[model samples]
Target chain A: MTPTLLGRIQTRWVLLWTIGLAWVLVVGPFLPLAGPSVGAVWLAGFRTLLIVSIVGTAWEFVYHGLQQLRWDKDWPTLFGLLVGLNEGAVAYVLLRNGLPLAIPGLTVAPFVWQFGTVWLVVWAVSNGPIRVLFPRWRFAGGRFW
Target chain B: MPRTLDPTDVPTVLGESDIARQGRRVLRRRFVTVGAGLGSLAMIHLWRLAGVADHALCAIGPLASPSDTYELLATNSQIPRHERLRSDSGSTIDAIWGWPGYALREAVEDSHPGSAIQALTEPVLHEFFTPKAGQVYRSVDREAARLGWSRVHQPGWVQMIRRAEGGGYWILAESLDDGPIAIAAEHVHVAIGYPGVQLLADLQQFRTDHPESGFRVANAYEAHGYIHDELLTRPSTVLVRGSGIVASRVLQRLLDDVEHNGAQTTVIHLFRTYVSDAQGDSPFFRRPAGNGFAYQPFNYPKSSWGGQLRARLETLDGEARAELIDGMGGTNTAPRRSWRRQLKRHEGRGTYRQMHGVVEKVVPTSDGVRTTIASADGTVATVDAAYVIDATGLQADPTTHPLYADLLARSGARRNPKGRLAVEPSFEVTGTRSGTGRLYASGAMTLGGHYAGVDSFLGLQYAALRIADDLAETGALPRIGPARSARGWLGWARNRRYDSNGVLA
Candidate 1:
């Protein structure tokens, strides 16, 4: 990649790393520990939680800044907030609880990977809409609803 | 505006009926072209904004003459009364003595929601109220005649005043009335609407500039099929763009034609957004909704209008409506109940298919045109089509219309990226930097301004009401207070009955 593109990626990674550290500090220890016999489930849950918290917290700040600074109240921010809040909450619970139930196995990787896959699918869907109705809406204003 | 001519004394020329003669006369009157300035884009904006405060007190002055006169006639049967209303203004509305589409009408009247906008409303309603074709222009000629106003076949501006003491408007002809009528009213509404055939120039240029790409597109609008017959049919593999109402109809027509001709033509439709086929899952006929196509409205009552959708949007705000329109992929192509059943039969046929792609460049080749398509997957494909019909959507340039050109030149109105008029919520074009007269716009031209994706019958009616509201503020057209009568209220109540009812119900 060109230096400029690599620089952007580097900046994003640094920011994510910083965020991941902060998340681990605040919610990591409080998270339930995995049962020794169910090591895989516990590791899967912890990793899932770590990724969600990191991505969600990062996106929330990004979208919040965009909405406030750019006046870009359109899709990116609105949708980001929606996905962030919902998926982030799920990841948070899984990380906190699933760690106690984990059983050791490499298959535990699916927990973290599932969300990334889903994110890619959602991102694809968000690129363009499918099946729209024309003259699709009407708006009322000026007190006389 | 009334002209006295006995029916018996009327002369027949070219075996034409009196109605046809009158239509011709109306057409002739509109041929009076004026070389008014397109004016400043700034001025246009100011005029639209100014119109709002001006129209706040404007009165629509009761539905002129025959409208009032007809109501009186309806009360008693003594004098022989015509079934329809004929005004001194020469316009008449066909009377379907009984409510023909009362079921849909009742639904609109009854459950008209309060303007409460939230996300998900557009989709929720789309599943309920579907839009139909040719409903917007159904009564244009009738409405024009009723007002004794001739339809302007060509676009232009006429000086409402000859250099008035303070200098008045150069009114763009929405429709022309008899004898150069002038309303002392300050606001001149330039509802040039969508700039007809001139709107397609960009797409025309796009297809023309790129001849080597082999994808075929079919535009909803065809003038003697010049583009379709000459270009579209020539391609072996065609990829049509857009998913609006017109696009839906064109696809149906293509399939119908292919069936009729027994041609194994491969058709790929590109929809920016995929709406659930209103046809659902019947094996024989399922079809996508109409998201981009709007044709002549002469065929409406036989087809349905988006009466329910209008009632639904009446509850949204400008930003919310924009979001809704954007979410709906900026087009209206609700599927017809019957047509859906037919389209479903071709699931595996090479004759028809749907794909999503965006065009970056269109280049012409020695044999045919080549199109470079970037599918949503980021895969690039270069294909040559015998013909390309850009049913993509309306691509208009304000500069193309003489009045808008004049207005844009002077900075009265500014053009959007799509080259349509940029207006405020009140239909005022935004760039009148001075913030002066508040010149409001209406019709298709204001697509992006306030109610984007709005070019349907109810959409037009909703816009008409907005214009009427502004006119009411101006006191030019006297105000008839909002519908509050028991009967009017009853009409409203009766209309909302189907708000929660599904189409199948």
Candidate 2:
């Protein structure tokens, strides 16, 4: 239950990053940008807050099972839903910033993008540092499936 | 809220902890049993803030199209006793055999104190009883007058609201009768019927939540009734679910329609359990006696004496009783003659089929509904039908009933796991201490609790008898003579009365 320094990053960092990125996509088009904007960037910021709250809550539950019931199966569902949401948010931010991206017609109003971000975060964190720093914490036998 | 501690603080008397006591109390009071434990859980969930908000939203929202007709209390109250029994025209259905005339007569003869009361009811009741279950309408005026029960003869929407304890209710009442003058008793017997019409409200909400998938998901009772009414107009294909009396009746209605109207309506039946035939031949293909087919009704010998044997077996332990029930069978097999005739007629006709499975989802096809039915083997088969009749079955979840919220709030009532009102063997709500106004319940609401089988007519009658006995124990039924001791005899007589005109009154 105790949180380590890096654990905090593992938990909170991606959530904030996903939200910050999603804000640029959802609000960029509507914001008062010099060339193309007519509305407020605040709209996107507000949406990012909502999307992040949903995505973060979902990821937290997956990374640490509800009340930390490790073997409980709800983690899979939580991971999947969050990862999908996170992916959409990433694509949206890339498109809004005019960065070269493979995703076509990127838009991120939906909360699905956060799902992907959380799913990846859980997979990486569970298998990465936690396994290396605390090998004992890793599930025994076959690679923490 | 913390559960009140046991009155007797003696450690020996306090057999259970506060939480366990609370759970048991809720179970006993709400009549929760193993079969219906989930319903009580759903009811508890409904009590949460989120649950209440969801229900409130449902109440104020525009109702979706009802899976079946919504029978309101006002319209039902207005239906005269005579007209309610038969179709609007009041003609007896001679087409179907075994009209229950003998049962109706037996019920009357058993009920009557003698000639006088018999004369008043026998003829009129006989006239009204018919094939359809709901049509047996009694004035309630007479029963109400005799029992001192208050009758709301013709209630409207406003009146129903008032009856629902103020306004803002969406429940459609078919009838509302208060038992003759209050016996100042603790228990109340509520018997509207299984899968009552009020369920339409819940169905409306379900359809609203899943609008894209909403198709013809009607209950067996309503669907069968509809088939009998508009046989020729039925869409080409139909899907019926659940393997119960209702399923059998629905098949009979469809087959009868094809026979009478020469229409081509394909019927597919669904069952949750796989029925293994001894000979691998459809039960319908075998003929039994003169004219009638020897269909092996489920629960076999027990179904023959379904009333007595079930009670006797339930007295045993779970494993023993399950063994007994297993020996009996879970689904009913139609009479050989009826199934044979229909089977032979529709064998190559491309009109009828029976399958055991469930629909995972229903998608609207351009021409009809494209349903994905998952069999027991995990095989998913797609069937396209112009209309989809759910006939799935009913849920006892208190959430399904409109009045549950009010009842729970006003009284510290908790639903049993079955989602119906839980009561003890004495039919008293658990957790309710003595002097809590004996609020007993009857009908399927108490199924899996003290009194099982509150769904069947025989079951209802048994429950009524039990309630009567309980009330008598408490000296509630002051007018009636000594309580009847022989439950089976009473049940037999009641069945006879329903049979007088081949229609149960």
Candidate 3:
């Protein structure tokens, strides 16, 4: 018997997507944008790193840091390349292909524009072990992460 | 962190990697039965009552039996010893049958003549009697023994359900003494019951701030016997939160203390939503208390189980259906005549008060606790209570359970509009079907989808019967026609065991 590739997603997938998106939303565009005019590529890449690393890490809490399943440095790196990048691209493609699905106040264009950018921001920033830099989370081979 | 192991090593001496053992420990096992297995408490009872506890089905969970936790709650709750359950008497744990029901059977067996009708009309006669929690326990345990429950019931904490490369699900579970037991089955029924309460944010913060509060503030499900021992005896004021059955029961318990011990129990009944005029406008023509609870007789209209209301619910989709659940939902009780009379007595005695407000904060005061409440009528008020009990219901969040967490994490399952599992009519979890291995679920975690009364006794039986029919249709089980049903009924009556699935035939 073999484990599904979905293993990387963590047991609480809802918490992963939910708490990740929620944390990103609550923090909003409040992270001081790095500089006067950050590169769009850097913005997207940075967000992907943050969303995946932070929220995704939170989801993996049961099997990681708190639990005995030690953090594997290669996990975020591998998942970033394998899952995050692909998810972002697919979400983008789906958003584009499904042209005009209208809601109450907004048109499809702005909706997709906002939705895609947020997803991209999530995709860019959510990478590995960034939380380890925070004073609180530094433990369990935190220096290595 | 899942591992890919050879089929031969399905986790050591799990079901059968090598030598055979007696009872639950097996030598070897394989299956092509349709919907080869089921999950949760519903599955446990099904195996026992269907007399298949020794056959194709085995209930594996962290409990010795399905109703272990539930029976404990029933006994512990302050509900009167003779009080009838809110569910219909005809609904039972017997998967294939609902015979003499609870009241009549108990009445006849106990030699309490004509008490059956009196039990149903209860409170009116000042003498209602549902089956005692003891009766239910004895019945289930009796059936369990007859059907060799311990022999087939795997007592273990399920860790994960990963897809087997050969198809079906590889269920990995750990027994405290026997280590990990991995069983490969075509179907898994997941019913991990309730996970108690995740107190509202403010209450949680209150607990965090006052680490030594002890039982002063706690969920209604957790025992707070101090109410009887210290608070009620000392003429204390209790801040009771929520408006559902638990709230009503707590209020009743307080009043009982007043009567028994002559304690001056001051009750501050707080409600987040109050229906002053319970028979509200636009009421469901056939249903009562659809506009919040003025104490509805039952949880949902009995029809919601499998009658006209259920059919209507099935026809609805998305927001409309969600709105129905919300409308019918809230702290509800049947407003039993005796409980209501007791409440009236207490209120007339000037010891009980009802208020509608959302608690904004709770800060410790010199004598007790000062609560900041924002009233429903655009007003803020302060109330003091020696003890605060959160009667808000169990935390129904599916993500709290590890198995559900694993399912959502991997198997593509999605929560419904109400934030519980979205399941099909067969109670099959929507996204867990792979090859012939289909997964089914029931109980509170699957409340809003197709089954409105998903947590009720009848709901468990209804879901099990529906799933069993689905399995039988797919050749996983034999259809219990009249003959088989009758024979199975007799086996149960005679305390003999015969597998309803024909697995042992």
Candidate 4:
């Protein structure tokens, strides 16, 4: 996808608000019921969302810089898939180590499940449904709105 | 209906001198798109999206639907209605936004999740998704109907575009039934597709020398199904020339007949320059090559559509732009697994062979044709084949076309370094401005300009968008901002006509 910096930021927020928020609300309530969670699972979910959204904006700058090095100035779908793992790992490390901020009652299994599921859903939606619902998304460099 | 003019009063060559001539019925519009093909269709779609009414626009061409000629050429090249084209899923012509692409639509229509998954993971985990030619045609037809294309369509062959007395241009066209008519418009868009198919020099000479053996040689872009029919019934040796996508398709068709229909066909594949391995100016830019074919998912790199290459090209001009275009240019085909397996099996059986040489001559023989070939090392060889399929591709040079040739001679328009009609980043034909009227061009005729993939579906849309924006800047049409875009898209979804005053239906 050949996303401009603005396009990347806009898509990030759109996905976060729609798919990401829906995942947090629907899956967050069930996370506590599935396993032992100390603090509010919903708080952790919202915190995770906030961290990724803010940090992802910075990642966009880095991605844009890397894009310039390539002749095509675009990322292959494979690269997009791979970058999700990188972003997830970065988010995981920060949440665990409490560098910027910490998510209460966050465990490895729950964090992995939530983060991985959100990434996959977001990726699939962006590649498929987003294009169908918002016709200008692809032409505007992935900016849905 | 246009007012009937006396046939004898029409001038042989329309110019400023004939502007005062009587008996000329001049229909005027704010915009006129010359070729009623995908390019023109895209431009009109964008204009309508920007709230331009149908009455202010005129589309002049012989075909009623934009995809008519495209469908014909595609079918002739072995891509029938059901067969998938070599186009990308997002390279849609009907919709300017390029959303709800063919893949997504196919996924929902056929209830096949695999199509959606394939589109998502294309050129990476899976082969790039290409829509069927029939689906694309159907979509274009539906869109043409929605846009009320009949209202703007002028049934005629555009003869020439001359500057009007005061402003705009006088577009002269010859109606098959009504002789000649003129259209005056402030803006003109030229998108006449490829002039015709191009045959190799030796093959052209061969056709010239042996009149009776004309049917023995055929261009891939033309109807040559008789060869396949003949091969199905009898044993014959077929010689395939060139190494483009069409060459591969033709090869696959022949091998398919051998595999499915049990035809005893021996295929000789010839390549002017056989690419055995990955090669390019730099490692990062290298294209994968194997089995005598250079592999690219599409005709050009995906980035050329809207990525870094597109941005880079806009900043370049003349020889620099031409050099970059050449770097990313050449004959390449997608690497389909089925084609690979078929070729491998045939090669193993000694039925399919590859030859590397330049064709020196082709002479008619009793059974077929004898082709003389010269290798790079000065070695010469001859092969006898019952049929020859030249897949060198279509002629795209604008000078060879009568209309473009005349346009260049009369309109002060210049050719780019690559011998195509020069165009700016906005797709305006350089030096072709007449008073308040401006001439813009797109498609194959405007290749080697600011865009590398000008002939592609997305490329045409990009050119149209650019032209629309340029016209908006000149106060010819309203700018399609966020509010207007949203409203237009709503109308598009509802299948309502686009009215500038926000009225639907």
The candidate that achieves the highest lDDT relative to the unseen native structure: 4
- Give lDDT: candidate 1, residue B410: 56
What are the per-residue Cα lDDT tens digits for candidate 2 across B1-505? Answer: 1122222331211222432432321111111111111121111111110111211111111111110112232122222222222121111111011122323333454674342323224222322122222322221122222211111112111101101111111122221122111011123333333434332343455467667645445554342344334547655787666554445555666777788867678886656554544322334122122211223422132111122233344465435544444343334443334555675667567676666566576666665666677877778998777555544345556544444433443344566545566666555544433242344445566654533444433343334334444545765432123122122123322432222111223
* Candidate 2: C-alpha lDDT: 0.36
Task: Return the TM-score for chain B, candidate 3.
Answer: 0.87
For model 4, which pairs clash?
Answer: none
Task: Report how far off residue B126 is in candidate 2 (Å).
Answer: 22
Q: Which stretches of candidate 1 lie over 4 Å from their true place?
A: A1-145, B1-140, B150-167, B172-185, B196-218, B224-236, B271-325, B335-344, B360-367, B397-400, B409-411, B414-438, B449-454, B482-505
- CAPRI grade of model 3: incorrect
Error of 4 at B473 (Å): 1.3
lDDT at position B416, candidate 1: 51
Candidate with more favorable, higher lDDT: 3 or 4: 4
Q: CA shift at A123, candidate 3, in angstroms?
A: 66
The prediction achieving the highest DockQ against the true structure is 4
Residue B356: error of model 1 in Å?
A: 3.3
Per-residue accuracy of model 1 over B1-505 as CA lDDT, tens digit each: 1232232333211122432443432221101212211111111112222222221221111122212322232212111222211110101021111112222332354564321111122122322222111121123323223222221122222322111123223221222333322232234445433344322343466556553332333344533244334423543555566665445555665665566655455666665555544322433122233422322111221111222222233346556655444443345434354445545655456566666667666666665557676877789877675555556444365565555665665545777534567765545556542212335555566655545433433334444445545645755343323222222223322432111111101
Q: Fnat of each prediction?
A: 0.00, 0.00, 0.00, 0.29
Over B139-160, each residue of candidate 4 has an lDDT whose tens digit, in order, gives 8988887777887888888877
Per-candidate iRMSD: 18.7, 33.4, 28.9, 3.9
Q: How many steric clashes between backbone atoms does each model show?
A: 133, 82, 31, 0
Question: In candidate 2 chain A, what residue range of length 10 has the lowest lDDT sum?
Answer: A136-145
